[model samples]
Target: MKYLSFTTNCVLILSFVYVVNCANILGYFFFPGKSHQFVFQPIWKELALRGHNVTVITTDPLNEDIPNLREINVADSYSVFLNHEFSNVRRESTPPYKMILFYQEVFVDIFKMQMENKEVQDLLELPKNAFDLIILESHNKMAFGWKHKFDAPVVALSSFGLPVFSHYLHGNPIHPILYPDFLSEIRECTTLVDKVESTYFTLSCWFVVKFLIGPEADALARTYFGNDMPYLDDLEKDSMVFINANPIFSDRRPKTPDVMEFSAILPIRDTLTKDLKQILDNAKEGVVYFSLGTNVRFDHVQGDVKKNIMAALGDLPYTVICKWESESIEGQPKNVHLRKWLPQQAVLAHPNVKVFITQGGLQSSEEAIINAVPLVVIPFLGDQPLNAKILKSNGMAETISPKELNRELLRDTILTVARKENYRQRAKELRDIFLDQPQSGVDKVVWWCEYVIRHKGAKHLRSPAADISLYHYFMIDVIAVFILSFYLTFKIIQLVFAIIVGLFRRKPAEAEVSRKKKKKN
Candidate 1:
């Protein structure tokens, strides 16, 4: 009896251990940009804190001393971004074509650099190394190769919302009219010409990804993960979930079951530095927060644009806190304060901040909305124009076209947002909606991630359409068959009608000849 009791206790302990085992997760951040890293870092940190075995291949590693957490820093990829980064993207922001070039030339290079990193190469060499799941950035689909390498589930996270190309993975329909392409600057109530252009641009973007980027990425995947692995195209269909950083206020659309919106994952704290607090406290007429986001440098702005901005801010009565990279402004204003970098969220959270002049990146846009600060958006490139348009449409912001930016326009827009009570009211309303969700964004992510681990790849959540080809999904072959059937039916009907008319004409002629012969006799 004693021996049997001891065995029972041992079995119970072993079962408990099996149930409580921590999942081993691998995260791949192929994009080198800081903005992308900012969205991903919080999630990785949270996973580690929860006692999961987390390993990440990223440009911006946590660099913290944490047990059971490994971060492989591929900082070398930043040089590629620096070399390809262009400041004049505003002028060259043509839809679909320019974006295609940017992705093919710049993003492709960044991914390759990350793949060729010493750590990444070493990891690929070890076929025995395993992971429970692989998290990838949606921008670089090449990272999906890890899905096959580890034979694990893929959870794709997009820092800048889901592009039209990615909708296919979730079996989500691409309704061009309602869901405009991120790069296509078409609003819902645009003109006929704009709608046509938007549709063409949207289709063109799909073409580029399908024909240009997709094939090249497949080749790269083959090089790293080997040809024996599932085709790169098929690998994406195996994704468990798509976590997008797209705020609900930005774009309204119907998402499939597998897509999740966790845009509010970033924590918002109202704390500020002592120096910044003193500055804002001293400003009696409120303050204007200005930032062009991380990539665009103020120093690189054209001379005229700089002069116009300087003059506009110089004339404003409010204190201007601009994120300027240069050591000194050409003509400094007494009311304006220049800083190389400021704690953006902390500054925006202040009650004294009247207006936020932003370049309309997704992260900055969410920050602005959450903090209840009105905006004067000056879009530069990518999805900035669309984001700016959305904010303006919602009555929470105003926009000054880059081409039309002058001292007068800049000053007017800022004044309008700062002085207008309606913008602030609308902004506050959005903030409430954002914060009123049933659970925190972090909690939602943690729950879903654990759910995926428990279910082992979450294959039950996947759609059958996700595995189908584009031709089959759209029913191109079915349409062709119908068209051929209709043509054959029309030809048969035409032949029958011609024969009936010929017979009627011959009968009439025969009757006339018979009547003439009777009269002559």
Candidate 2:
């Protein structure tokens, strides 16, 4: 009897410790862009390494295999749409608005299906209170509706720079900073335009989601899950957000209590490839590496643009390695070699690599800074313009308009950027800023994850919702201004009317007095 009692006590203590030590973390990543994977992979890996049970719900399968990584392929068919050659439609495609519409349509259906499906339900219903915390990609605002189902703290991962959705969650003013005034741009100082624009953009986005995409998503949700999710506006106010952008690259904007900035999470590889290293070792002049990034295909570029680029390279005496999709170039120059795939980081690390010509994607930009390579950007679409603008403003890069894709402009810009020592000096300075941060990007993410696990709600750090009302949050100051203006206007108008009445009365009284004086005489 004594022996049996001791064994039972031992079992009970082990069970209690197991429950205490274990933490359940679920990450939801549904963005279509492949670049997001690089940003997310390290965080997931670090969590798993720390002995936390990490499950990643992704749209596509990841190539890297890691223990505790659970990938759920939610919308595999969307890949076909993403990889489709839209450039082949026409030389001058008449407003590809149809593409945006198609994306919205497909996304609404897939998101609804994923949320309502039995498989997802089963996952959600996993042993009672299975997860300690849920980390969602901030871009997937639709997922906010499902947060209530999980009994854990909801943390958001923003892979992009400071976005509106994240800003809203932290109870911060989204307007003035996001939508600065025209004059603000001129002054290069603070303005209310970012706030106004942010407010307008937020409402615009909500309208698009609610009226345009919400009904479809709701109907689909009802059909699949038998529940009506709340409207998009109602859903956005209740989550924590973190942006994956370095402050060094972005304007120094104030952040609310709930919002955090952790960027450049991907591991920096500064080693040179064997082939590139060999070439650089023998090079007398130096190398200039060029790439337009993965999203912008070289084949889609106009023949004239390609020829102009090649012609520009012909003028340069330095060796240029261009990462192209095709093996052959019609007007290939002697100094340029077209490779289907070249180790980008390897080339950047080469001592001979003096300058980088790029499309200014976040990862590539980060890599260039890490490797201390100056840039000449030819941005095409999306956040490329913003990135290019930031880099140019910082004196670390030069932006060349794509319209001026001629030999002379390309050659001149490349030569100027390469020869300018200021660009390299500025890039290295920014690198120092990044290195001086409190912790590595990966380490910060891991620390936050662990901190959430230790603190049940993380409520102490959360920003209050009251601080984020549309009027007060945006700081329209409508009431105070209106009252003050109304009071002043009322006083002015009242004084004017009194003066007019007095003037008429004065004339009548004076006439009566004149008549009385005449009668008396």
Candidate 3:
């Protein structure tokens, strides 16, 4: 009886300690696209699984009842995308600078909707210091004010790579010629024209990010969170940034310690469903998977482009699986199969699965590498072009211009990747590198989240240059001081020389006068 009582007492004490150590975390993802969720959901969900009290303000909510996890659903947040067709947007191929404007307008609309959300407003009304740490998406800068309201440290997350302007958040170096913007076509900067184009893109986008987007973000932050909130730009200070791009295949650019990267954030299944398994396993001729990701709906892919793509797939001897939104395509080939939604990673993991033709979205590219499959990229817009180019350079993929795509070109490209053993071999090498990290991406994210809470923010790990002004960062003041000192020294020496010359002239004049006096005498 005595021993039983002692054991019970020890168990009670341990439980109390566990409860005390659990942190309260709040995560907000502004982008409503499901692809972004693939990178972020695993992170916040894992935190809750680890005994933390996690509450997420998200458009895509896991409506299940999980202990220690609460969902503040902002279902209407996706309304911002309903009006615009991304296929039309891609056709226009908006330049990097103009794309910023387009995104600014779209995000501003989302800001109003999210701020005006009743559940979100109710969340804000809760007691101060309610959260121990805050996780936010980088695209939504205004949400950084939540850090102030809750008095919590922030860990900024990006679904993809950061824009050139956002490099300042972690004091990462910004190089245009070598590390061009993701939206631009200038990947290799061998020519002067390439350098010129990259320079213009970097400078112009920086101006737009600071001047045009800054004021609007500030105003929105002030109105919603509080007028006392710090400037939108400054709120990124002391925050950790995690990018979804892996450094190996990404641009060979400089990175600060604060920036963390990961490729395999989403879960990959080892088994496929009954129907999918049967189809993939029986494909002796091999299999091809094609998808345009979430933004480019299949129904919108009409007229000549659709016809050519279909014609190409029809000619291929292998079985093809495509992610289609509609019930059925009109002229869909007998060899091709369409599913409204399919498990992407599991399908890619099949043995017979060969080359994947895709829109080359970041998540898609990462998945391709993670699954060890070659690619045939038909880039549409945004980072797709850049991702495609990088993959091609790595010997893991081929790039085809969307505007120039036709039956013969599409057919030949897909066949080349599938038949060429090198593409598959290179993909396997890259996949090994991506998975060679010490811990999984999800685990790394969870550890860092807890680290910030334990240390009361990652202030020590922060970049010294992150919070400083641009003039101070560039050492303009220090350079000015040196320049001024040199100028003053030069002027002083000139003055002294002038005085010495004047003294010699005076001596000569006096000597001449004395000579004249003697001669007169």
Candidate 4:
């Protein structure tokens, strides 16, 4: 009896320890851009630091060497599509639209490849009950399907701002009016026309994704998995989504239920070099730093636009550091220095660095605000326009459209952004707001990791799959109602016209008989 009791106690203790120690997390990170990788790295590192066995599948290699973090290279076949040839694809003449299409095609193809590859299959074949949780990049929309294959909680990380997704997880509308237009800072309330436009944009995007991208991905997934492919609904059902967005930067941030905005994940390096310290401490004239982001090529800018920016900057008395990739700026001003690469954060932190001329990438925007530097945004593609709009709305930045790139305007905008102390003050205020958040992005992610471990699975918090549908997900029902209403009105008019014609007919039966007699004759 004594021996049996001791054995039972040992068994119970062992089981508890095993449960506590077992945390296997797989992270699917398919973002191709360096900036995106940088944004997500801190959270990934944090998860690893917390003793969770973390696996990262990525297009770009990560810089950190954490023992628990496992790196898997997911090949990107869409290298041919990227506008700027950074590492691969030598040819450079492809049009932007064609390039975008090519990118879509390649992403579908690669997703299929990843789904079908022997290594990936082997990895998935690992006991479905093995992993504690799966974390994926939200942009890899297909990752949502893995929920069924694994007995684990799923989490999505958005490297960009939150908009459509707030509705996906929380069943709440992130009002489009919240995203301010760059040209107009005043709260532009959503109008009927704006709603219509938003509906059209959402539907158009859905149509493209479903008809163009979804079919191929579905076919590939089905072929590899030997089962029906998981649909968009499946993706949404399995995961708790989070956006890397700061409410302080957004114009009118909507309160969301499930999805949380933890934008402070972009970690600032605390330790500064003596030289960097001196640069910040011993500057009489203010400094200006410029970077066009990783994806954008400086050479792609038209000669006139380039000349205009250079000419405008020539008049500015501040020291300018431009991350220009081009061979030479022959008639460059003495105040401007061109470099292939510069210490971006160090420059931003410098007390002398008063203004930032940027491509309006999220990471750059976040960095500027964190370091209390005002912005002059030259937006290119994707979320840059939205970021620019947000910054402009927050009174922290001024945006100049790529189309309106000229020396006078460029100089004027720079002068306006730099001269006005309001932009700087707003940036500082946002910095405080970001810093005051409950926890750093990394810490929030770590907390989630532990929560999943404690709970076994965070299924209680997941939004119901039945609540979301294709038409409902994109708010297509609202559009359909308007269309149906118009059609019904037209049908009613046609019916009334037919009735009126019958009533106006002078002796219908006699007229019909006469017509028949004439036909017989």
Number of the top candidate by lDDT?
A: 3
TM-score of 1: 0.88
**Compared with the true structure, what per-residue lDDT tens digits does model 2 show for residues 309-409?**
87888798789888887867776787787778776777887778888999877778888888788999987654565677777887888888676678888
Lowest lDDT block of 10, candidate 2: 180-189
Return the top candidate by TM-score: 3
lDDT of 1 by residue, 1-521 (tens): 99999999999988876445578889998776677688888888888888899989988887888898899998888777467655666423455756676766787788777878788887887654478878888677777889888888778777776777778767877778777776676757367876777678778878888888888888877888888877676787677554555444445667666677776547753377798899999888999998998777765666689889989999999999988886467678888888887888889988899999999888898888888999999988777888898899889999988778999999988999999999999999888877677766667776777788778878887777787887999899999999999999999998999999999999999999999999999
| lDDT of candidate 3 at residue 401, scale 0 to 100 | 84
The residue pairs that clash in candidate 2, if any, are 175-194, 175-195, 176-194, 176-195, 178-194, 179-193, 179-194, 180-193, 180-194, 181-193
Which tens-of-lDDT digit does each residue in 339-402 have in candidate 3? 8887888998888999899999888888888889999998877778778878898899999987
Can you list the residue pairs that collide in candidate 4? none
- The local distance difference test score of model 2 is 0.67
**TM-score between candidate 4 and the true structure:** 0.74
Candidate 2 residue runs with Cα over 4 Å from true position = 1-20, 59-65, 73-128, 176-228, 232-235, 269-273, 465-521
Model 3 stretches astray by more than 4 angstroms = 1-20, 88-93, 269-271, 300-303, 496-521
Ranking of all candidate structures by their lDDT, best first: 3, 1, 4, 2
